[model samples]
Target: MALPDLARRAASRPRLPSLASQRRVSLCETLDRVLNKGAVVAGDIVISVAGVDLLYVGLNLVVTSVETMRNWKPAGTPVRQPEPLSQEIRP
Candidate 1:
């Protein structure tokens, strides 16, 4: 019996980036450049319900910091997957 070449096997394996060497950022902010904070216009199509007419709507999204997210999880606790439902199928 012949043994497999260990050097060739190791070379074929993929190398992953080190977790410690990765960029550590407490918070990352991404701002909208096209229109940082402004209002948008919509086509003229007015419809009234009861007695009020719909005009316009705008939304702003804000992301929380990394430290706030990490604190949410309990320390040294394992996540358990929910068990599948037990049901009988009709033929």
Candidate 2:
């Protein structure tokens, strides 16, 4: 078949229905998925002037859950403990 005929036939055909689910996800679930499975990007930026390197910047970004952030601790750093609530009555 000619290219124009083939194009016309294809255009005349009905489009297939979308495969996506009709249900809507809640805000909490969306937030959980985004924070827990988000991508981490680490890179650097370099600026050159007249063929000479002028400036360089390093960037490291992480998007994660609050629990993950709380559990993360730097090497050799002491872990902090939450202070107990005072039982004394205030006047």
Candidate 3:
């Protein structure tokens, strides 16, 4: 077929519906999926510049539910509160 005929056929075809016109997800559902069932990423980053190693970084990430965070506490360590800012005296 000629180029003009191909272009005409393509233009006449129906367009697919956009995602906005489809189903909508609620904020609570999105948060639940992200915070509760999210993926955990554990990796390291190495930077090299001018044929020499410059910086090495270790990255560990954990994504969990709010309940897990609330119930988590360090072993054999007590939670300490910071002193009030007003109690500090400066000469």
- Residues 26-45, candidate 1: write the lDDT tens digits: 21111233234345444566
lDDT of 3 by residue, 3-85 (tens): 33432322232233454554433333343454446555444554323311111110001112322433564677553332231
- How far in Å is the alpha carbon of 62 misplaced in model 2? 22
Query: What is the alpha-carbon lDDT for the whole of candidate 2?
Result: 0.33
Off by over 4 Å in 3: 1-21, 43-91
- Pitting candidate 1 against candidate 3, the one with the higher lDDT is 3
lDDT of each: 0.29, 0.33, 0.33
Residue-wise C-alpha lDDT for candidate 2, range 1-91, written one tens digit per residue? 3433432322232232352543333333333454445554434554323311111110011112322444776678754532221223569
Error at 14, model 3, angstroms: 28
TM-score versus the correct structure, for each prediction: 0.20, 0.23, 0.23
**TM-score, model 2 to reference:** 0.23
Better of 1 and 3 by TM-score: 3
